[model samples]
Target: MQLLTTYMVRSQQKFATIFLISRGFTFQTMDFQGKYHIHCLMQLDLKFSLSFNSFTGNVPADLGSLRNLTKVTFSYNQLQTRPDGLSFVTDLTNCTKLQLLDFGHNKFKGEIPASIANFTNTLHILLLGSNQITGNIPPEIENLNGLQLLTIYNNSISGEIPYGIGKLRNLMDLSLWGNRISGPIPSSLGNATQLLKVQLQENHLEGNIPLSLGQCRQLLLLALSDNNLNDTIPKEVIGLSSLCIIFDVARNFLTGPLPLEVGNMSKIVDVDLSNNRLTGEIPTTLSQCLMLQYLDMAGNLFEGGIPPSLRTLNGLQYLNLSRNRLSGQIPIYFKNFTMLEMLDLSFNSLEGEVPQEGIFIDTKRISIIGNKELCGGIKELGLPACKVHNTKKRRKLPKLKVSITVTVLFFIMLTCLIVVVYWRRKSATRPSTALPTEERFLKVSYAELRQATDEFSPSNLIGQGSHSSVYRGILDGNQLVAVKVLNLRQKGALKSFLAECEALRNIRHRNLVNIITVCSSIDFTGAEFKALIYDLMQNGSLEQWLHSSENQSDMPKLTLIQRLDIAIDVAFALEYLHHHCQTSIIHGDLKPSNVLLDHDMVAHVCDFGLARFLCGSTNLDASQCQASSSGLKGTIGYIAPEYGLGSTSSLLGDMYSFGILLLETFTGITPTDVMFKDKWTLHQFVKAALLEGTKILDPSLLSSEHLAGINGGQSGDVDKVRLEEGVAAVLRIGVLCSEELPVERMDMVNALSELCAVREKFLRHGM
Candidate 1:
């Protein structure tokens, strides 16, 4: 390590590209000392990138001594400052040739210094996300007329978005989510015709969305969910046909009818207008969006039956018209949506027989619970049967036909028994991700488990947590399994084990991590031992996909649609836990690492150590999500804001964690990222980005071949637009669900409805 450090110090002049990505190196930490940043470093046009490294300490000012430095990529590091408040950025102004500056995803504390404006006009892209920086963005930031991408997302930035930002004619992307910035959005941003993505959700921004945005002919994605923005949506803003990705403005006070001109966004993928005051009939012109996969208008005042033109959106995966005033028979054409997975029309005044075909075949996939007057075609719906009708054309059935049908039934019954037996046998295979929910309890000793994991060898260890260590093992029959051994020495390890046992005792779902058995015995040294054995997921955890390192070169990056599917699967598991179980269960911790993917890439929610059971028929909405606990539970960042105030665990808290998971999955940003510390949060960062129309996309989603598969077989540009829009749509769902206020947050039911809508198009295209 010392040798490498010395080599780096001596060869600073020769170092042009310091790309240190994906090594997953766990050696001792290395410090990039101030001595290495001297003027002798570069002779000409140097591009230094030390991303994804463990380098520590403050960024030295001497880095500016390199007059020829053009690009600096210092992301994903431990570099921090001591009350410096981003003063490191001040030194970089000396590099007049600098064009790109990225210090994102680091532990840098402090503000975006005023010197940011002093950088040469050649500077285009500036990234400072996921930091502990605080303060308002300087208005002089517009001095960099050549700026194209400016992202300061997930920080504690305050004050208004700069009014002078409109001066940058070449600007394309702007992301500034999760800040305390308040005031109206600058309408001058409309002049930046090159703008493509704008994300500014989760802030205190108010006033109407600007009509000038309509002038940005190249605009594709726009998100402004979870803020105080009021007034009706501008028709000029909503009518842009170039909006190929997402158009989100949910959780605002936007009043009045949804404009019929919304039909102009023909190439859009996801559109969310939920939790607003928008009224009037559902627009029939919405059928123009042949590529639409997700459409959410829930919590609005739209009245009428499901539009007939919507039948053309057969590619939809989710359609939510819940909490509305719509009244009429549920459309039968809904049965034609072969790709649809969730259809929620709950809390509406609709009355008619519910269709039993397509997505309605499974009661778990659809919700119509609050429509008391509706009758059902399926008995599981618990609705009254359709009224018996006597038609004038009643005819007698032939005896020969009845006899032939009876014969067929007899043959079918005989065939069903064989199929059932085969299914049971196949389901018993231990290597699969899913285990039989009901089985004879198996008795296993500590010695037997020790043998499966080679006597608990470190080499066999798969994962380690605060109170448990997981090891991969093989049973007597070559059955692969994961063994989570409890850490008895930890403070609450015993309680965690007990809680997990209680949570998993009576509930099971296909999307949930499956446990096989348990071992409570004594180890060789007479020490107490307890471990849980679960079916091993062949594809590993969702963390491996979203945050892949260089060691993961063999692992293909998950496409936007693929990530959407995984997120949907996790949401389904949580929905089953919080609402479908005999007794409501809350998985207190819901970060990406806890989500395991099977060989089929299906996500399974796991780690029930912090699970809570909400016993009773208490209504979650009325309860304000209060559940008693002795202390705070759940991982930081993902935990609900109320939990930090000694509020304990609740159904709402789980929803918050799920919301963070949704954001992380789509945007590839962790809930506890360095940028979301103190008063700043992941929800706000994403929200602000949506509101300000900034670019908050995870670049990994559009790199290499991932873009090609995002839009099915569409053009390259279309692929990018649709993929980004889909991501923004899912990110908005996350934003609403993870809002600071429990009441403002979308419940599990509504979130699932929106997610089901987001993943359909990709699934239909076989993504």
Candidate 2:
């Protein structure tokens, strides 16, 4: 290591790139005595990135002498300096070509140097987050007119945000959250029309939100929550159509009614205005936010009835209106809110009967703890049964008896007609068959299904399962479909059929197979017949594409990008079912065969027969989900190890399965492959291979044709590095997801984020 350092110091001109990422080596503390030779390298124009390393001691002060330096990232290191000093920052002013500078997640203390204004106007990004930087942002920062992103989060910086920041027309992202900043937001921020994301949450900012902020027509995310802001939300700000990700102003002192134009954010996914002083009714206009998935207005002063139009939010999953002044009955139409998962209406003045349908069936999911007038929910809610208040009307019942006698005489004649019809049905001996109470499927007859499948011929058969056979067919003479016919001869066939109908009818997603129709009626043999029809997947199941006979010659191999896309699609599907659905659905059997791909290779999760809904969305504290299922809920190779220990099912279990699927996709090896024997499981196999580089990756992804010239040129090696990095990221995520302990596995959301980051890096690195 000492020799390498000496060589780097001597060959300064040739040292163009300095990368020591993830080497896990620690450096000794050294002050450099202000004589570091790196100052000589400044003339050569270098690009240095030492992220994810264990570098200690103060950063080299001479680094600022590199005028030709373009980028410097030193995040996630152990670097530190004197508590009240940032001398190196002042030195960096000489680097006229510097466009990116990041020093986040380190112990950089003291006030940010005023010399920050000396940075070149070409600088586009600056990240100083997760540090001990103090004092207010220097007004002189406005000098960097070309700045695009500025993040200084998790700092002790104080004072009002400078209005001069608005002068930077090129600014697009500005985040200063988790700071001690105070005072009202500057109205001049509206001048920065290119701003797309603004986060000022967790600050001491006070007063009303600036109305001029509405002029940022391109803003996508606005988070100003956890502040001292007061007054009503601006109507124009609420009406910004470009705000799509989230608009959070919760935990503030804001008052007055929400603007009626709140419905204008059609593309927004989350709206949080909770823990505020806001009053008046929830705007019925909120129903117009068709894409809303989360809405929280709890701990407010909102009054009047819960808007009935809220039932129209078909995509809403989380709704919190608790601890408010809301009165009147809970909207009866709330029973139609099929997508609602967590509904908190507790601590309110709401009166009358609570609807006993939809999410209301789960006591843990729907809270009404403080609403004394609420009654008639499930017995578990401990509310009294609803009763009539008008007892005086009982005395008038005697006068109606004479009229009731006449009505009885008329009913006797009707009974004679029913008896004649009943005798005819008894002679024919027709057995009454009960059908499952399906929710949202086209009700079809047995004859229609038979005709669609050509009388259930073997030629139409596409796939066969334990208790059902799927056949490809055409419905209504044009709609291509896949009909799953159940065989009652199996012991649990009928139960599986009902379970699938109940599961699929209650949930829907683009990644989930669409149930086109269902047929439950008597067949030609006078016996019960049941089947479920789905939109046909032209490309068939992923299982066929992975392991089918290669001799067919027409089958297309899945490239690395395609596999990554499929992994993302499956992860999203599981995220929706496990976290975003009205109730968590445990996909007991997640396997390659259960994953269908359309003509575009977009994956759709299928076969909910083994699926079951968990009572609570995230109440996996004790495995209540697993206890709800009669037996284990997944296939052999992908099943979580916890399931074998008699533990209950949980979202973590599904994550385990997804992890196995990702590993299998990248390695082209299944858990049940013949080579996996004894203690050499797929997880251990892949984990070991990751230690050996890309030896376990699919050959088709890293063919010699693409890798041969990779050793010839600098750009070739860069592409090769990116490819390896992408593969390493995938393998790392897979190993983490398939950990032995369920709690050790990565959450689906975090996994998705890492996958996205890796993809972005691959694109940016030109791979």
Candidate 3:
């Protein structure tokens, strides 16, 4: 490896003058000069590569002395800082052949030098992403006319994007997201007509989206969310017929009805126009986009019923119209969307009986919540009975006829009295009973569960974790349930077993898994144990969707908004357990595997076997003892460091676990994976990156399988951009939640609020 490095350096000196040896290559200063002199035979061809046996130190500044160098790739390995006073190799102007420069996925720091623009003659693709490069994007970058793909995302580039950016006429993809860039998006960018993809989200960019962008006829994807862009979406954008996906102008002050022309975009697929001030009814014309797959118009002012034509969209997989003013009955035509996997119509004013036929048969797929007038078909929502009222008036009987009937009855009563005495002796032989009152909960028998589970057949098991096995079963001959049989033997472990049962019984939240009943009895083997019965969550656990190797194409991969929603759901559930429950419940073990999802993909935190209830004087004593003892009580990677330091398990401990879960949700990697070794808490990982202005998690770490499932069968530029933005949003939320300082981390309310803000912004942008 060393000899190869030497030969390349010697060859570069004879051809290209400049060379950069990254990855800690070692060479004597005298030998380096000799090699450069030896290679000074022709036009210096700047070239360099790292060797495995290289010595570690700062990148040498002397390489800048070789002026005729271009094209450098020094990524990976453990190379440290570049030498002080050295920016771009000063000798590079002589070579003028530099085009592709990849310095990403490295530990480079300091401001991007102004001299970077010197490569304007030939530079095309500049990848400075995933680095510690700070400061504003240099105006000189506009000089690179040949530049096509410019990725400076995941940096600390501040200040407005230079208006001169329009000069890059050949630019195809520009990603400047995850920066501190502020101000309105430059309207001049519309001049870059060749641009196909543009990502400028997760920044401080503000003001109206430029209507001039309609000029970019070839544009396929555009994302400008998580900014302060304020203005109505331009109706003229519909002119971009080639546009397939758009998440423009989200989290902004935009307000207006959706342009009717949006329906004209026949090629468009996914649209996220949520969390905005947009008013007026959703245009029925949107139904014309037959290719539409995912539609999220939640947290908007869209009123009236959903468009009837939407039912014709058979390819639609996910639809969220939650937290809106939508009214009237849920359209019966929704049954036509058989391919739909998730439908959230919660917090609407819709009324009437929930549909019981077709897709509605899977109640979990439909979320008709916060609609006070809705009734029937579900016990979970406490729906009123669908009763028919008699509209016809009854005819009255004559009073004289009634008086004659009373006289006949008086004589009959005397005869009946004698008959009653004769029958009383016979009646005494019959069983006696008391009048029955209504019961709040049903008593399900253990034998019945065994029968429902087919005598605990392994084939019926849906999931098996460290604590229990969850099985899908039918109860009372009809109702479906999820039975979680505990691993503990009830005969010997009655105390701890009962404690868990009591904890689950007392805790109740819409987001927490509901415990329906408990079965505690001896099995055929005469071994007693307990099993918990809950409403069957057909969607399965979140871990399966995130990390399972099953055929998941049939399942809907969570969009950015959906992931945030689930994260917020889990956060709120934890908050309620810690603060609102009768006793503060510590979910000693909270991980993705324990978080179950219903058919709608709404998350429910399950598995409370290790839950610790803190209430009363006994709780205080236990707390003190736990605080003084060094013991860990959480998942391997998620447990807070303070816990090992003998700190009491407080709400903060749960927060730490939540942070890990958040990161896993974003990266789609398990905390226990080899990639996250070396005491690398997700919180610490994200925090360190943010402090250094670099991307915390590598996007490549996302499994190809998961990415394939998310983007499978999808083509066109818009679909790609939408998917990218969705991924970006998830990562942003993860970073925000995993901030090292608990105070810096957003609370559940604030996190949810911000999420809704992002949703509304997207809606206004007509994404």
Worst 10 residues of 2 by lDDT: 7-16
Residues 71-149 of candidate 3 have per-residue lDDT tens digits of 6665443345556522643434444777777666555667777787777769887887766767888898899889999
The 10 consecutive residues of candidate 3 with the worst lDDT sum are 34-43
Over 4 Å off, model 1: 1-44, 392-767
lDDT of 1 at 766: 48
lDDT score of residue 7 within candidate 3: 39
- Give the residue spans of candidate 3 off by over 4 A: 1-59, 62-70, 76-80, 83-86, 89-94, 246-248, 389-767
C-alpha positional error of residue 607 in candidate 3 after TM-score superposition, expressed in Å: 67
Best by TM-score: 2
lDDT of each: 0.80, 0.80, 0.68
User: Model 2 Cα RMSD, Å?
Assistant: 19.9
TM-score of 1: 0.49
